[model samples]
Target: VSEELLFRGVLLGWFDRLLVERPSSTSLLFLPDDGRYARRGIQGEGWRRWGAIVASSLVFAGLHVGNGPEGHWFGPDLLPLFLLAIALGWSTRQTGRLTPAIGIHMLLNGLTVTLILLGASSS
Candidate 1:
C-alpha cells in the first residue's frame, strides 16, 4: 500500500540521476533547479494551493501505476493508496511542511500491513 518508494523515491531518484546523466534533457522534462524532493511536492515559500496538492497526488499515483501488476490495477485495492497520496499531498501543502505527510503515510502503511496480517491469520 505504501508505494511511496516507487512513486516518490524511485521516480524522483531516477529523475535526479537523469539530470546528471543527461543535463541536456532535463529542461525538456521540466526538471527544476532545486531537486526532486522539492519538485515532488515539498512546498517552498507560501502555503501551496489545494489544487496543487490534488495535481501532485494524481501525478504521484499515475507514476505508481507503472511498476508492475500490483501497481497497474485501478480497482478498490489501489483506491486507498491514491487517497492516501492525496491526503499526504494536501497535508504537506496545508502546513508547508513534510513531517505531517510522512507521519500519516507511515500510519496508513502500518495499518495496511496490520490488516493484511490479521486477515491472513483469520483466514
Candidate 2:
C-alpha cells in the first residue's frame, strides 16, 4: 500500500501531470465522452508519456539498488528491476489509476517472497 502510493500514486502521477494531458478539462470533467477516455491510456502519445514512465521507472530502480539479495549498484538484478518498474508504470498509465500498478507490485512481491522461502526450505 505504502510503496504503491508513494511510487505509483505520487511519483508516477506527478510525472504524468508534467508530461501528459488530462483526458478531459477540469471544468467539464463530469461530461462523458463514452469510451474515449478509457481508450486514451495516459493521454499524450509518443515520447511524452514514455518519457514520464521511463523517468519514474529509472528512479524506482535506482532506489531499490543494493537493497535485495541480488541487489547491487551495478548488478544483474538492476535490469529486471528497471524493466519491472517500466511495466508497473505502463500499467498505471493504461488504467489511468494506481490500483493496477499496486496490484501488480503486490503480486510480484508475493511471488518473489514465496520463491525465496521455497528455495530456503529446499536448501
On TM-score, the candidate that comes out on top is 2
Alpha-carbon error at 3 in model 1, in Å?
A: 7.0
Give the alpha-carbon lDDT of every model: 0.56, 0.81
* Candidate 1 C-alpha lDDT tens digits along 4-119: 54544444334434432333555647755667644444443223344444555667766556443355556554565568677776565466556676677788668878987898
Candidate 2 weakest lDDT stretch, 10 residues:
37-46
In angstroms, give how far residue 23 of model 1 lies from its true place. 24
Report the CA-based lDDT of candidate 1 relative to the real structure.
0.56
- Predicted candidate 2 versus true structure: per-residue lDDT over 34-88, tens digit per residue: 7666556544455777888898888899888887786567787789999999999
> What RMSD does model 1 have?
9.5
Which pairs in model 2 have colliding backbones?
none
Model 1, residue pairs in steric clash: none
